[model samples]
Target chain A: MNKMKELSVNHLLGIKYISEEDIQLIFETADHFKEVINRPIKKVPSLRDVTIANLFFENSTRTRLSFELAEKRLSADVVNFSAASSSVKKGETLVDTVNNILSMKVDLVVMRHPNPGAGIFLSKNVNASIVNAGDGAHEHPTQALLDAFSIREKLGDVAGKKVVIVGDILHSRVALSNIFALQKLGASVKVCGPLTLMPKHIAHLGVEVEPNLDRALAWCDVANMLRVQNERMDNSYFPSTREYVQQYGLNLERLQKLNKEITIMHPGPINRGVEITSDVADSNQAIILNQVENGVAIRMAVLYLLASKIKNYD
Target chain B: MSQKQLLNSSEMTVTLQRLACQLVENHTTFQNSVLIGLQPRGVALAERLVEILKNDYDLTDVEFGKLDITFYRDDFRRSGKVLEANTTEIPFVVDGKRVIFIDDVLYTGRSINSALTALQSFGRPLEVELLCLIDRRFSRHLPIQPDYVGKHVDVINEEKVKVNWSEDNKENSVILIDE
Candidate 1:
C-alpha cells in the first residue's frame, strides 16, 4: 500500500472512524515528532499560525496536559477551558461555549466531555476541526493511539500480538478506543474484569472476555491495566476494592508466574494497589511512563495532521 | 516530456571524488566537523560522499547524520499538499562545530532555508556551509548559494533535475527533464 500524507478524516473523533492506513500514518508521523520532542529545542513552528482551544467538560489530568503540551511543542497558540471554571456552571450550552471560542478564530478544538458524542455534536455545528480527548465512556482516541504506540515501541510491532485490557472496561473510553485501535493494527484483544465492569455486548466488538486475571495474563503478550474509575461508579459494580484487588490486581507475584515476558501498560492516574500494585506498576516491564511520553508525540501528530487540513480562507 | 543527461556514472564518480578531496582538504580528520544530509533526496548524496571520504581518503571518524526540514518549512498551511516528513538521525551535537549540509540539488534555495531553521534544534554550530551536487542557476527564489557545487546548470522553473543513484537500482546519472 502507498503511504498516506494526510489523515483520511479531518477530525479524530474516534479510532473506529479512522482507517488502518490512517493509524499507520499517525504512527509514522508520531515517530518524527517523538524525535523532535527529545531534542535540545523541543518545539516546532509548523502550527505557529494555527490556534487551538482545549474544552474539557469533565475532569482530566494527563489527557488535558498531554494535549496542551503537544500543542505548545508544535508552537500552536493554545487556550484552555475547564467546565468547573467556565460559564457552563451558569447553564452555558456546549454549542454556545464552543461557538464563542470559535468566534475568536480558533482553528481546532480539543474537547473532553462527560457526555458521549459531544465531539461529534460540536463538529457538525462548528467551523473547525475537533479532536475527542475523551467523551464519557465512548472514546479517548489519543489515549488509545499512545497506548498502541507504546506497545509498538516495546514490542517490534502490534500486529499478531495478544493484548488484554484489565479492569473497568465498561466505564473506560480508553478501553473502547484501545480495542478499536489494536484491532485495526492487527492485534487480538481481550477484556478481563468483573462481569459487572464488562459491557454486555462487548463480545460483539470481537474481543474475548476473560474473567480470570491469571489466564488473561498468561494468554497475552501485553497487559493494559485500566484504572478502577471510582468516580464513575454510581452503584457498586463489585463487592469491594479488596475483593477486586484479590481477584484482579496485577502484583509482583502474579507477574513472576508468567513463563515469558509480557509488556505492561497503564494509561495513568493508576490506582496504586487496586488494578495494579505499586511494585508491578513501577516494574521494568511496565511502560506507563513511556505511554505518557508517547501521548505528547501522538497528540502532536494528530494536531499537526488535522491543522494541515484547516484551510486558509485568505 | 524529454530528458537530457547531465552527468553519467564515470563523470559522477570523478565529481564525487573531487568533492571528497575538497572536504578533506578543509576539514582534515573531520573531528570537529559534522556532515548533515537533507532528508529523502540529500541523504543519498551525503552517504556516497561519506563512503568516499572513508575509503579513498581514510577519514574514518567523520560524523554524519540526516535532517528532515518538513516541520520547519515556511509553506506549512499555504500549500494544498501536506508535507511528509523523513527520518532525522542526528546523534551528535552540532554546537561549536563546523557543519556541512549536503544535498543532491539546490534549486530555489528554499530547502536550504528550511534546513537552516531545522538545524537550530540540535545546537548552535560555529559555522555552516551548503554543498550540493547540482546547482540550478538563475532560479533561486531566496538569496542563498552553495559553497560547494558539483555542476551548475541553467534550468527553467517548469523543468526538473533528478539525480539517479545506483543504490536505488538505477544507473548513476543526473537527468534534466523537460516537461
Candidate 2:
C-alpha cells in the first residue's frame, strides 16, 4: 500500500498552516457530523457553552447561513453582526471592532470582509479563534475546504486528478480557495480565462494558466466554474462580459467536448450564459448542490475541530 | 490478552496455538475456511492468526483477505470515508465458508458492526465468528461478542486500551492508558 500523505488545516494568517493531513481531518470531522446533523435534536454538545460570533463585513448567503448552522449544530451560542449596521460605519477601526467583540467573551469569530488579509489582521487583534469566511479576493478558507470535500467525496480522490477552474480568477475568493484546496488534495489545478482576467505570473502560484477554454476543459477531470464576481470587480477585469463569455463560457458545445466522466463543479450563484450555460449548469455531472450540503458539514467540522483544539489544551 | 499472557511472550504463543485449535475444531462444517480482517486493527490480527494457525498445523491453504469497510460504514461520511480503504476482497466465493472476523480489540463493536455491513457486499458466508486479541469487558455497545479471546479485562470509563504490534520482529503487546 502507498503511504498516505497527511493534510494540515489551520486557522491563522497566511495559507501556510493548512497541510493535507489537516484537510483530511476536516473532511473526516465533517463527515462525522453528518449523522449528528440528521438527528431529531439536530445538535451535539461538543461546544455546549462555547460562543461564536459571525462577524460579517461582506454580503453572503451560503457562507453566512452555513456558519450559523454549523455553530448551532455544535450547540454553540452564536452572535451575528451585519457589517452595514455595525459601529465600523461610525468610523471605528478594525482593531476596535475586534477588541469590542472580544470584550463580549466570544470564543470564535467568523469574519467576511472586502479587503484581502482583513481576517488576518482581525486574528492578530483578538484571542478568540478566527475563521476567514471570505477575505476580499485573497482566500475563502472555509469555501475551499467545502470545495475540496465535495471533489474528494464525488471523484473518490483528487490526488493527481486534473482540475481546471474557469471564469473570473482575479476577483474570486472562491477561485483562490479552490486552487489552494485542489493543490493540497493532490489535484493538478489549472486556471483559465482571458489574459486580463487570468492571474499574472499565475504559474508561480503552482497552477497552470491557460487562455484557451477548450484546451483547459478537455484537460481536466473536474472543471470548477467561477462566477464573474461582477459585484466585486470595481474596474474592468476584461474588455466586456459578452466577449469573455463568447471566448470562455461553458456552453453545450464545450460541455460535449469535455470527457463525459469529467465532473462539473461551481461555487455558485452561477452567471447563466456568462461563465456557464443553463444546460451545463444543470447537467448530470454538476455537483453544485452537493457542494452546498457539504458546506454545512465542512463548517460544522471546522467548529468541532477548533473547539476541540481549544478544549484539548485548556 | 490477559495481563500475564500479554507480558509473557512464551505464554502468548501457547495461547495462540490453543485458539487456532479451537477454531479448527468448531468450524468443521466447511471444506475451506477463510479469515477476513476488518481494516486497521482487524487486518493485523488476521495476519497474526494466519501465521499462528499455519505454524501449529499442516494446513495447505489458509487464506486471508483485507476488507476495507470505508464505503460500507454506516457512518461513512462521519467516519470520514477515506479514499483508501484496505480492500474488501476475498478472492474465492465465500458462500457457505466458515469465516472468522479477526480484530485486535473488541470495544463498542461498531467496527465489527461496520465489518458485518461490509461482508454482505461479497458472496455470503455460511457462518461468521468473531476473534479478538483482547476482549474489553463492559463495552458491548453493539450486539457483538468475540467467540475466541486471548484474555478479558475490565476497563474503566476514563481508561482506554491500546494494542501495539511491531511488524519487523513480529512482537505484539497491550497497553492500558488514560487520556
What interface RMSD does every candidate have?
3.3, 10.7
Clashing pairs in 1: none
lDDT of 1 by residue, A1-314 (tens): 11338889999999999999999989999999999999999999899999999998898899999999999999999999999997999998889889999999999999999999999998999899999999999999999999999999999999999999999999999999999999999999999999999998998999999999999999999999999999999998999999999999999999999998889999989889899999888889999999999999999999999999888843
lDDT of 2 by residue, A159-248 (tens): 988989888888877887778788877788988887777767678879888889898877888888888887867787678888888998
> Which candidate leads in TM-score?
1
lDDT of 1: 0.93
RMSD vs true structure, all candidates: 1.7, 8.4
Please tell me how candidate 1 rates in CAPRI terms. medium
lDDT digits (tens) for residues B1-179 of candidate 2: 23323434555566667777787787642257788887777786677667766666655468778766543344422333223334345676677777888887788888788777556656578889998878889888888889999878788757777776677424656777665
